[model samples]
Target: MRRRAVVFVALALALLTAAVGIWLAVAAAARDTDAAPPVSVSPSASAAPVTADDYCYVEAMIYYRVKEQELAETLLRKQGIEAGASGFATGIAARDEDELEDLRAWYLSWADARPAEPPTDGPCGGHGSDHAQMPGMPSWSALQGFAAAEHPDAEKRFAEILHAQNAGMIALVTLILEGDPHPAVAESAEAVLQQAEADQETLQGIIDAVP
Candidate 1:
């Protein structure tokens, strides 16, 4: 009888020990699971905020060229502009129209879609009035004044405005070149910068000759 009682107590202690071991293992696993870090998720490109870069240079250039082209065509339509000024306006109109078409195509290729015509009202808006804050962009009143001027005044006004706008575009193109622009955008910007520089030289001569 004594031997049997000792055997039974030993069996109970072994079972208790086994249960404790299993409980400890389960508790440790739970702690490890609780301590693990959360899985991270990346933000989507489409979720990019409006304040982000969004290739402002490309769109801004398009806007600038559109306005420049319009002004050039306006000058061409006006009477009494000197032969030199008329020729300059004609070149500007033609060059900008071609560039505008190229830019539209480039934008479509880059974005996989076309940007809105006339753009929306912000930096991303290709032709937004907000971009008027850029240096050398003529104000509404200045555009009106240019439209109304005649003869020598018209020539002088066109030279002054176009010169300023050209300088602004050159600066913008230079900035894009300095930064990490897309290959297509960089190529277009380089062409624009070169043309704008040459145009500026011509415009300077025109301004100097203005009587």
Candidate 2:
């Protein structure tokens, strides 16, 4: 009987030892799981806000071009000139339309991105008092004169206007491509500049043929 009792006690001790070992293992695993830290991200560090000055150049450009192109189209129609003239005015209407649409889209985007500040040169102040002007821009009188002149004379005026606009376009695009952070704006700027350069060459050729 004593022998049986001693054997029973030994079996109980063995079971107890195994239970302790399992408890210790489980506690270690739980500790390891709890040791992992939570992850955190900072908003300021992740996305920096773009400043108003950053996009002011584009805003000014878009505003001026929008007005100028609108004026060109209206004048063309009012003058009873051929918007689709075989040579000099070839596709001028269509090109102006496309440019106007692009300018409107870019203007809205730039305006949204820009902070509230004094209206820049290109943006029309809701009141007549404010007007947006751009580099290489011609006077209102010059635009008016060119728009009113007839056929051959208007043709010469067109060439001069084209050259001036092209010069401004090239300079403005260079600024965007070099300094602007917006990728889409930069791409659009490049596309417009290329088209302008091509248009300039064709318009200049037409002018050269005039005399």
RMSD of each: 32.9, 32.9
Tell me how many residue pairs clash in candidate 1.
Answer: 0
Model 1, stretches more than 4 Å misplaced? 1-54, 112-130
Q: After superposition, how far is residue 96 of candidate 1 from its true place, in Å?
A: 1.4
User: Each prediction's Cα lDDT score?
Assistant: 0.61, 0.51
lDDT of 1 at 62: 63
Question: What 10-residue stretch in candidate 2 is worst by lDDT?
Answer: 123-132
**Candidate 2 C-alpha lDDT tens digits along 130-156:** 223455565655655654566656666
Q: Judge candidate 1 against the unseen true structure and give its global Cα lDDT, from 0 to 1.
A: 0.61
How do all models score by TM-score? 0.64, 0.57
